[model samples]
Target chain A: MEKLCRYETDRVGYVMVLPYIIFFLIFVGYPLFFSFILVFHKWNIISPMKFAGLYNFNFLLHDPLFWKSLRNTLIFLIIHIPLQIIVALVIANILNQKIIARGFFRASFFLPVVISGVVITILWQQFYSFETGLFNTILSRIGMTKIPWLINTKFAMPSIAIMATWKNVGLYIVLFLAGLQAIPSSIYEAADVDGATARQKFFYITIPMLNPTMIMVLILSTLGGFSLFIEPYVMTGGGPINSTLSCVLYIYKQAFYFNHMGYAATLAFTVAFIIMIVVIIQRKLFETEVYA
Target chain B: MKRIIFYILLLIATLIFVYPFIWMTTASLRPEREISYLSPLSRNFSFGSYITVFKRIPIVRAFLNSLIVSSSITISVLIFSSMIGYALSRLKFKGRELIFMVILFTMMIPFQITLIPLYVLMVKLGWTDTYQALIVPGMISAFGILLFRQYFKAFPKSIIDAARVDGCSDFGILYRIIWPNSIPALVTVGIITFMNTWNNVLWPLVVIRKTSFMTMPQMVVLFTVGGQAEAQVGVQLASAMMLAIPIVIIYMIFQRHFIASMAHTGIKG
Candidate 1:
């Protein structure tokens, strides 16, 4: 509270922040450090750990369930990334237009995000019910038989994918809308004066202008797709098969269900490592491709 | 012809996007057995199933639990982080860059990485199954402080200096000079943190063992999966609707602020 050096203010600030800093160290830093140690030894936290060396990592690499979960995560990403981008871009573009009631349209577009994920997931679970779901009701009216959504392995991952995208795309929509608004209107007007068609203006002017936002959206969505936990956790419980078993769900099941803390830690580390590599690659890709 | 067709297609796309949510709402209102009847879009609805869900489950209590957890976390993070944010931005200090960098790095580490350790900490603290477990651990969010520092740095420094000259204490200057200028940033952090805490599932699932202690999302998960051997689809939808209605109402009130907040926060982070 008293003056010394600017350094003293830093000291005072650190003291002010001591509580949070300590909490982060104990909670966040401790877990992160121990998780690595966890990957090395086989323990359920109740039992004495047996040093497993690289066995956990080896087991994770060879484990069929882990591979399946990783594959499922990739499939979720493949579907989610494109769909989130396209839907957000289109909806943001429309909302950005000088059309009527922009606020209303934007609010409607973002409605899903404000709602709870558990609510959204359950809503979709009901929507996915084979016997009495909203999907089936609508399909039946469209002259189709009931589709086994969650139960059928073929449809489960995609079903989860669609629901996840719906619940999350609003966040991306807002991001893109901000980017859209930040683009100088003069660019669009310049294109118009140059006799650019509407589609050309969109392709030439809008797409190029939104590059940074697109990259951010891509990385965020990729992180999201990999961290896929709750939807599949609640809806299908990771499946009729392992069709929708995301890596996080697999780790959760291993740790909580099977009491394989060591194995689950390995799985989490593996996924986190993969996510880091993906982020790095995305940064590289965006850096080179943009402003070229 | 082509333009009309394009407009028609956009309308249809919008319907496809929205129709399931609309149907979910209707089915949630229908009698349980009537949920299977195929006229969700057209059918007249009743509030009976919603009443049934409320009658059958701990929906009201969970709603209150969620409100408390979300609001407490939001308010605490707003207040404390602003204090820290002001000091970090305005006050010169040693190791400031290191501290700032630590906050940035913490953002990059997904919260899941800390979940197990934090859980162990909670159990050891004997704070498990209590609101303290949820609220205290997250009170000084690095993300909020970082965002607020970015905001506060842009405020007029002369005003804070003037307040300091006029015999105001450091905290008083922060409260009187910079705090007013930073309301937008506070709202931004508040909405994001509130929504985040409200939707938090994995940590709460690990920490909270009792159904009586459940948040709305927790209860929604329970009501969906952990009922009598037979689950009623309509009731589950009803539970979701009840959990979501308050959020949607709030979103309607502050839609612009919500959008702006999320946008600036995301872009900054």
Candidate 2:
């Protein structure tokens, strides 16, 4: 009986984690494995899936819409990556000091992070309205004529990038703030004592110390850029001529809207593969100080 | 002089950040006829737009569905993730490392990659249009587990050791010792999970086919493009504001925690 009790404790230690393991298999592991199988099959629910064998991938390589989605997604990353990091770091630096209303300022920044994306999209749609929008209101006040924020193909992706940045900047601000606080005051004091200019101190002390945080921010923001859907979907309808159609959004359009499940699944796998490759290359280059 | 300039810039930045939301609330207040012609900020606010938004669609029901899904996901995540986190952190069990590696691998894979296959799985199970579609899949979150594990690993192990020596059971150590001491981390996970599930669009769009099962974001998507005619912009804004305001209220209460949780998850996920 004593031996049995001891063995039960020994075995139960691993047993306690059974729930998470089961859930991981169901939700994550199964789906990941199935996506591989799905990429080759041309089945749209109810029809028997034929083994198309590399044809789906071939189509993806040649499809203009796929290429366009990729281009738009890259365009999104271009606008969002640098903008998200810079704004977040600036806000984090400003708030990290002995500022008054620190909590209030922090909340004001983080407020959008909690609001639903669809809501933000809907909200920004009105904000982008050509005539009565607050954007045009500000522009007209600045003596510039009204601009088509979402309707103009050129402006639409940038506008989505703007909204995406706002939605996520709060989280990055906190990250930078954490990184900033982890820097001891002694380093800054030593820099100040050396008569180093504030610019030099910021560039030399702050930037170098925050490298890991910056890497984390870069990986995260890039991931976010790839997954974007709601902003462009709601604000641009992926249009005013497909100007803002993101890769994930395009995949959704093909899979759900048009029932091109095989093509959509293939496109989805390519994106996931691309994200992995991008992160791998990024890690290599980041370690080598090669900025992409 | 520098301080003044900084303050002024901060003020202006805050205004720019907040202007659209303020405009949304004000726009939702204006009379229906006056929506597009008048300035969104200049008009006297009215509750008529709110009435119209509520009346035109299933806004109230959608809000409740979102509340249910977000809360369920958050609560379930907190319970399950914390359980696994405590084990992964404190238990000297075999396969703990393997479990963490699994969590990490799953965390890096984006949702869209798994989404199509998961839909097929749901169809096979005949679980379409049920709350199970929204709640079951994401209740085991990698980000939550990582956050809790990181936090709990830092928790002094002496307490658990003492409890074990005192003949407390394993779950006893978890329930009485770990959970009571884990309020901050739990709240952090709770805030983030609630917000993510609340804001989720793509999954809810795929799973919940019936208009009656629609969550708030899905409803906003419906109002935006789930139509033939031009949706009344004012009513759409009103519905969006309604979805945003409550979650934003919870976020405002736990704002610092929200940022901290999300920041940590960003690094670890």
Q: Pick the candidate with the highest TM-score.
A: 2
lDDT of 2 at B180: 88
> Whole-model lDDT for model 2 versus the true structure?
0.81
Model 1 iRMSD vs. native:
2.9
Estimate candidate 2's RMSD in Å: 2.9
lDDT digits (tens) for residues A138-229 of candidate 1 = 79888988888889988899888888888778788889988888888887787788999999988887888889988898898888878788
lDDT of 1 at A214: 89
What i-RMS does every model get?
2.9, 2.8
- Candidate 2 per-residue lDDT over residues B158-229, each given as its tens digit: 887788778888788887888888888898888777877887888988888898999988887877776621
> B158-177, model 1: which lDDT tens digit per residue?
88767766767777877776
Error of 1 at A6 (Å): 6.4
